[model samples]
Target: MTTQYAKPLPRVHDLNRAFFLGALDGRLVLQHCDACGHVWFPSAQSCPKCLSQEITWKPVSGRGRVWSWVVMHQRYIPAFADDLPYAVAFVELEEGPFMMTSIVGAEPEDLVCDMPVEVAFDQVTDEVALPKFRPVTGEAS
Candidate 1:
């Protein structure tokens, strides 16, 4: 079953194709620099730490916390009118990268700073699955 995906889609390119593909397969991946042992997201060509080109896509624990969040009171994007007042959050992954994502399986009123969360994939299309998060519960992935 695939979503109709009424919202906009992310552009997949050489640098970020793996990340999107991994999510479609229910895995969370980030860029790892072999030379400097640094990991990051929103994939890049070189390590932000040492500028090393020896990077590989690595799966992460998909565990994180709600660093911060805000309620979308306005329908800035018309497609999201049905989800007005939704929470858009910044998740600090345990692997040390911050991902701007939506918090799911919970209510916006319940969100708090540093709340434990884990990744959940919303398969919008056969090729794209957006990574969202949920409150931690019983060995959350």
Candidate 2:
């Protein structure tokens, strides 16, 4: 059997530690500004809108639409060479945050703008779980 190389995992840091930890527990969270009521992603120390330091992690509905997507046909990284032609999408969550994530459980040709999706977790390692998106079924978009 051939050894399968694992894809790169995100480095957990003080600024984004909560995000990775939240994924481990199956919760999708984003930083929310208490002052301006703004929500953002990729975890920051301050709110981009009001620039307030009073930021807190809040759970979102995990429902989003495919704002945009790209089919990566090139193998830029060796680890992901085997998974070529995958869809990397910009998902706009219902809470007003756009997250960069991969869309799984669907063909590349099937993706479209404004397509409804929901969060799904993939345990890449024992301590890390990456949040991905998939088509929502049996629910209104």
Best by TM-score: 1
CA RMSD per model (angstroms): 2.1, 2.7
lDDT of each: 0.92, 0.89
* lDDT tens readout by residue for model 1, 24-49: 89999999999989999778889999
Overall local distance difference test of candidate 2: 0.89
TM value for model 1: 0.94
Model 1: ten consecutive residues of lowest lDDT = 132-141
- Which runs of model 2 end up more than 4 angstroms from their true locations? 1-5, 139-141
Clashing pairs in 2: none
Off by over 4 Å in 1: 1-3, 138-141
Candidate 2 residue lDDT tens string, 40-117: 987888999989999889899999999999999999998888889899999999999999999998898989888899
